[model samples]
Target: MTPHISRKTRVTGAALAAAGLLAAGITVGTAGASTTQTSAKSAMPIKLSASHRAELLRDASTTKAQTAKELGLGSQEQLVVKDVIKDADGTTHTRYERTFGGLPVLGGDLVVHTAKGGAIKSTTKASKHSIKVASTTAKIAPTAAAKSAQGTATKTLSAKGADAQTPKKVVWAASGKPVLAYDTIVKGVQKDGTPSRMHVITDANTGKKLFQYDEIHTGKGESQYSGSVELGTKKDGGKFTLTDDGRGGHKTTNLENSENGEGKPFSDDDDAWGTGKPDDPQTAAVDAAYGAGVTWDYYKTVHGREGIKGDGKGASSRVHYGDSYVNAFWDDSCFCMTYGDGEGNKKPLTALDVAAHEMSHGVTAATANLEYSGESGGLNEATSDIFGTSAEFFAKSEKDPGDYLIGEKIDINGDGSPLRYMDKPSKDGQSQDNWDSNTGGLDPHYSSGVANHFFYLLSEGSGPKEIGGVKYDSPTADGSKVEGIGRDKAEKIWFKALTEYMTSTTDYKGAREATVKAATDLYKAGSPEVKGVEAAWAGVAVK
Candidate 1:
């Protein structure tokens, strides 16, 4: 889950973010069986039957205004329906974006679940803090804002010995304050041709540097899933472009050894791809394109998510970027996932889980908008790992059977070892298996281990375990035994918590609460899922 590059580059480590904060289900399919923990005993939750789901939706309020009021967002926020998903059971989950005072609130997105009869059962908010500001007017001139941005960008760039680019103005209400700000975007390629994009946020009111974060998310992906994939290609003048029509028209372009331009799309008259070798550039494209397809399928099939943004849109993926570039990244500014040839173009970073990891970042941006720093930053990274693993299992590909290891095949370390491990995160000698006050001080990649451990414990229990042929020996910080609720149920719980219960500033503690609440809602107050969640967090020393 490491994107090679750092998460947010606060104003020289000044913590770039909104100076604000606030505060499922076990139903799934399975392949092979693993050791299971005892069932949890909790109050009754929905059994997730088709009849039950249908009943929930059959009684749902069709009137948008009525539903908004039911969710408690009808007061000052306008609910703009982003997506409405009705499961097989007829239970409808509605996703929404919020606007306050005629301006969009960045972290104010949420989802509401309604039982049968349109009665709102529960609501999950991205941020509990109200979106209120004293003023939206800018006291500082645009020139001053630009200078502030330029200075901050210059300082940040100089520290890295890079150059700067132009800045633009936008209304930022992410901090619950509608303030005018300059979104200074700096573009420059490193000597190695790795693309650099710095998003520095400058306050328009006082010309103060509010916050800054890097747009490039460095992580590490091929026909890596299935030996062959059914791709959606378009024939242009007898040339087939690597465009996926089924998935919001996602296109995988070849960099042709360049760093930035959208290279020519892989084309073949016969629609045959590469030879799966470095000498043939099309090989990497096949992996990129195929990986993208599987990832799209994973989200859509299991989670019912439309796309990375749930907007029924596809994001472009660039393959074969730069020379010997060993990293892959997702940039929200461009809404694309980019991959690089590793070491010598022999190891294309386009692996199954890798693709899922990168694209999950986009999903995060769209949903919870988790700030990519501190504990929240760690959670953001963990979310990627969680989904990446989930996607791997969801695909259930023979080539890359689901496993607890990340980047196992990429060889990003130039060694045989995988990037990270979920069973015992500390095996890498960096990640933390338990939570502590100082956990936030660790790098997002390492700090994420706490959540990773929690998830592992919840899904697979503690002590000795094996899944899909991989061996694991998990332990708890408190030396307590933890029973798992199964990965399927565990993942649903995590996703529910992420989309509905968590806020932008949620930390480890918040995560524990959110997940428990999600379990309570999805399964029942005292259900096995809820108890498993509690024991898992305790296993990770989070409680």
Candidate 2:
């Protein structure tokens, strides 16, 4: 139940309508004057220059040896740098992954903040307890663990003919206490066309199944979701190829209705693509290419991220995958996006928001790497939904206007109803509108409702409203009124939190703390934006 929004609706000066002003807890008269104040306070944080970023990475690498000792980690624990971010005021945030006794430690990622003089400012950890295990030896044999893992995938995931890979030793510390475990990856085809990479963690000493999560993410979608959109194609001797040279050379290929392997690359004699109708195969290709390009532009233009991996390397998109497959997915292993022809192969799941949603999974993988299970999985899905909606709004497509509703144009439900609604997630029936004890037990798509509701309130506030001709009525958990800080600010806060503070094990509570810290970093402490973030989270029962 992922969703996808535009920047043109920004509140400026007296342009802040009565509804928006009221939503912000401001009077119309003061709105115009407050605009300037807000702009100064909410100015974008300075991005790290290439040279400076390189320098920080070098420093981080040199300091890695002492990190375990300095942080009071066990003698067998070691730190590996993952990412580094430098703020405008010379503050640095270094993200790292941990290994215990030479074994990869699940949920052992953390971020360390430092001042200008290199002194530690604060630390955010996925696990608080020290990394210590009884022994590195595993009592459970790899074959036995793999067998159990494969069985779980077949029974729980309905994965037919699931094949288990060799189990690897690791330290599992995601919940409760740290323990040595064996993680086995089971591969198979899901009920849908999605490839299953279910990771099952088994206790090494007891040989008991500890946890399992599928690495593959799925979403429901149509061809030419955008009407007559322009595409970036490459010219090769009287022919054009669907390669976007401008944005990391992103290319679109045709799967030829097959579910296996990468298909042929899409090329056209003329630059024109799509008939705005599904009857044309190029039509679906047009939507997929356009959606990828627009999503790329949105990330680069809005967040200064060069590409999906922020490395200027483009990922490919494959369309027309499997006949009547009815789903779309992002596979990190392939580093590409796959779309299906829905229902009767008449509705290709190549919509703009769907592309954004799928690709945002790559962004998440490159950063927080949020585990796709329990509460963390919900946040992971919500992250994609939030950014998917943001990219849609950024695109501002005339044919498919940005809205809080997901899969509105794709018609995923067979009916005219949308797949999910951010205003009231429960509108989808399965999604939860607020956090509860059992939220973690629900599917990631359903549990994502809490964060979705919070984002809607943070961007548009509670109550009834209309934007882009779509009506919405967002309610809070406690029936409290929340003032919005605008989508522009909300997106910035979310992006910062995702890249800088969030980790693989972050849940709703951690998300709240990360976002508040992000708001405070972007704006001063106690700023209106910070208050708005806190209020929005409270509205969703996340506080």
Candidate 3:
């Protein structure tokens, strides 16, 4: 005779998330299996219907009883054994059991039963754990070539005291393949008698010297530069791009070997090349490096964080995502920032502000862990934009000036205008500087101004302020006058607040309180620092 008893324990998505975080799964029946059994005891296989599996996967709050009920199983039916089993007919059976004597239910366990004739007579638990399959991402970096004695294989160039070396570093590339790398930095002079510099090309693989070069200006006295280095692999193509601010203003340059075949323009559907001409791989490298370096420093210096996670590790940013995608985003799955070339006047979305904005998303994930949906969601988006702008200012990059505009250089509109206007929210058709129920309810990108304006007002008070030849006046609610806190302090306060006090549903008012609390914690309630938090919120009309 078979002893058949059903048992079940509820597992919610939150529980799963917690479990996953606390202890990763074990390797089960086969590698790459999604379902893993937990707990050990000789028990009957707790059979759950197909609907139960679907419900558990879809609903984060589902309980085992609810799942069982949905699957037409009795409430008392305990899930003693759950296994993804294949019968002789190749049909998958989800074996579950409800036992009168319940087995110990722990994570990563399987139930085994002895089948006497046609019924289960005895049951035992499998102590082995089942592991979850981790997704593998593809590595999409340009191939590196070997360094030769004369000039190319990836080798380091040694710098001598008070003297210069010939080829800083060189790598040979096949004639037809694409070569990609940035030019080495060189010293130069500005028209205004200021000193300028362009970073010498460093080997991407080994961080060694590849070549030396100088930045020059072109087209209406824009600071520019031209140079080349052996990036090593034609398999990825070769091109060098540079952003020079050493002189006075920003200069963007793209250099490619004329001999390398001309590449195609950007397209949206294409996943591999992203958007942009393949002509210059160096420019791509330059943009990627510059963005990563600036963001890495912003997190390190301002927040005292070692890196994104305070681990001193650098993340990758693919210059091109889709063809002419015209937007940049950070995907958690890939753990990377991807940019696209714009359709028209919008340049590539590789500006310092854009890069910082994308990178800040990673920081937000590491800290506040805010969900990207409602009021907290809007604050999250604004946090990125605000930090992005702050980073640009922090860098004082000659190529891209720090400003209130978000996609100024990209020229997305085909006109010389930016995508978002921070000072006067009304400049953009949708963005709102003032906070109200309606404003909070709008899209995060648009609703972002509540905090964005808050950041600007806090950094540079309400009223008129001109930067980099751009002019605007920020207004305040309650008409209380306040002074600018400057970006450095503002960033610190906001970061502290986000990582420490804010939650998923925190609103603009909540943000204000958090910042104030953060300020008090960092400086003091009556300190000048707290004054800025108060003033910043007042300027944004958050009250």
Candidate 2 weakest ten by summed lDDT: 11-20
Task: Write down the worst ten-residue block by lDDT for model 3.
Answer: 14-23
List runs of model 2 lying over 4 Å from the truth.
1-55, 224-226
TM-score of each: 0.79, 0.90, 0.50
RMSD of 2: 6.7
Compared with the true structure, the alpha-carbon lDDT of candidate 2 equals 0.80
**CA displacement after TM-score superposition, residue 313 of candidate 1 (Å):** 3.3
> lDDT tens string, model 3, 1-543?
333212111211100000000111111234322221111111112223345434533332233344344444333234432323222212222223232112211111222222323233322221122221121111222222112211321111222111112222222111111122323333333332222233344334444444332221110000012222111111112221222122111122221211111122222121121123334443454444455666666666656554554434455555443344445556444455555544431344555566678778777765554545457667888888877777767665443456777766555566867778777666777788778878756767788878888887777777876756678788876676667755665777787677555643467877888798666655545656577788778776677
Instruction: Give the poorly placed runs of model 1, Cα more than 4 Å off.
Output: 1-104, 112-122, 151-183, 189-193, 202-208, 221-230, 234-237
Alpha-carbon lDDT of model 1? 0.69
> Evaluated with TM-score, which candidate comes out highest?
2
- Tens-digit lDDT string for candidate 2 (9-67): 11111100000011222222343446545543443434444566667788898988886
Question: What are the Cα lDDT values of the candidates?
Answer: 0.69, 0.80, 0.46
Instruction: Return whichever of 1 and 3 wins on lDDT.
Output: 1
